[model samples]
Target: RGFVVFHAKFAENYRLYSRSHFVKGIELMILLIVYEIFGQPYRSPVAYILITVSMWFMVGTWLFAPFLFNPSGFEWQKIVDDWTDWNKWISNRGGIGVPPEKSWESWWEEEQEHLRYSG
Candidate 1:
């Protein structure tokens, strides 16, 4: 279970970081091209400022994407609250506390049943 949780978190972080970095890399390439073409001689401060501002905006948007684009329309705070509640419930009565007599299949079925009625 610990291994699975670690891998799941790692995969999710990898996916998010890779996607954002790929986009930033493309943006950097475009900026480099622009700098080479027009700003090479002048080394315009305006161009530098634009690039900096745009990069910051991109970072901000990526950081806030989960909150901005949540399909469920829940606020970030509400989502955090719900996640903590679920974690507490699971720790107290679900996977972490499964009885020795219960097989994995039965434990899973019990979880599903709990979800069906609770949710």
Candidate 2:
């Protein structure tokens, strides 16, 4: 049935959306879920309804609820290709490398240089 195909596609999209780090992905997944579940007739008489429903259940429990309730901001790609263990890897890989204590050193130098030109 046409509805069944749509449901299958929705499930696939939902899976990707839940796992994706980008905001658009999550939004797409939520939209698909609403289309299939919330926007529909009370129940489908089709026999395959159970199958797609199970797919939705699996995707929801494994992905959607977890992402919605306790989302992690960390990108998955960074950890996937990592060669070392968590302890060895630098958690601040994307941030400035300068240490907090020495940050004022660079800030002071830049400020002094700016004052020299203005004065």
Candidate 3:
């Protein structure tokens, strides 16, 4: 009776484990083996579809959906405010704007001098 119960318990655990992981693991292993066997010249349509689907899922769910999923995790409102301040500061500079190639330190000095002289 004790031996029978022990065997039954082991079998039950084995069955549960097999059900949870064995089928998926075996399928993945078989797929890898098949992929290795199939030379590059003969491509699998299913594999291409799977790869395309995965790429679409990743880009659509994460990259493009910024409001839903921010890749940088920056607040949208803060970003908008920063853009607004940058535009305001840039536009306020007189028609003769700072040259693009100048370093920030040099540009700042020139901007300060201009403001002081113009004021």
Candidate 4:
């Protein structure tokens, strides 16, 4: 159960890490996976297990250290509200159709109007 909570928190922190460092995070995970898979065959089981566990612990540390240290003040509700307001402003001012409800014709017309006015 404790591992479960740790895993959940790790997952969230991993998500944050991925969002913040998209390409690098994906590359790191891929390389780690490749190393584990390919390197396992050459090494003794004990060595392999120890190394992989250590690697994952390091990955976990990388994920959670920033999470614990840097509470980036990410307010989800405020972000959503700001996005909604921006969407409304853009739609009202003719950027495109509103976010949730959209149509091809309306989108095309709005884009056309935008192009006409901007140029």
Model 3, runs deviating above 4 Å: 1-10, 39-119
TM-score of each: 0.29, 0.24, 0.25, 0.34
The predictions' CA RMSDs to the true structure, in order, are 15.5, 17.2, 24.8, 13.1
Model 2 lDDT per residue over 47-112, tens place:
335636665565455554433443231336433332233222233232256542233343335435
* lDDT, residue 80, model 3: 67
Q: What is the C-alpha lDDT of each candidate?
A: 0.51, 0.42, 0.44, 0.51
Q: How well is each residue in 1-119 modelled by candidate 3, as lDDT tens digits?
A: 35331122222222334434444555555665565577474668677566556544543443223333322335566556545544544454433555422223334465367667774
Show how many residue pairs clash in every candidate, following the order shown: 0, 0, 0, 0
Best-matching candidate per TM-score = 4
Per-residue lDDT of model 1, residues 8-108, tens digit only: 22223323454465466657667655765776576676767675776656656655564455444365665666455444434544355564123333344
TM-score ranking of the models? 4, 1, 3, 2
lDDT of 4 by residue, 1-119 (tens): 35332222322333345445544545666777888787748788788667678666666665546545544324565446545654554455333434322323444464356667774
Question: Where is model 2 poorest over a 10-residue stretch in terms of lDDT?
Answer: 4-13
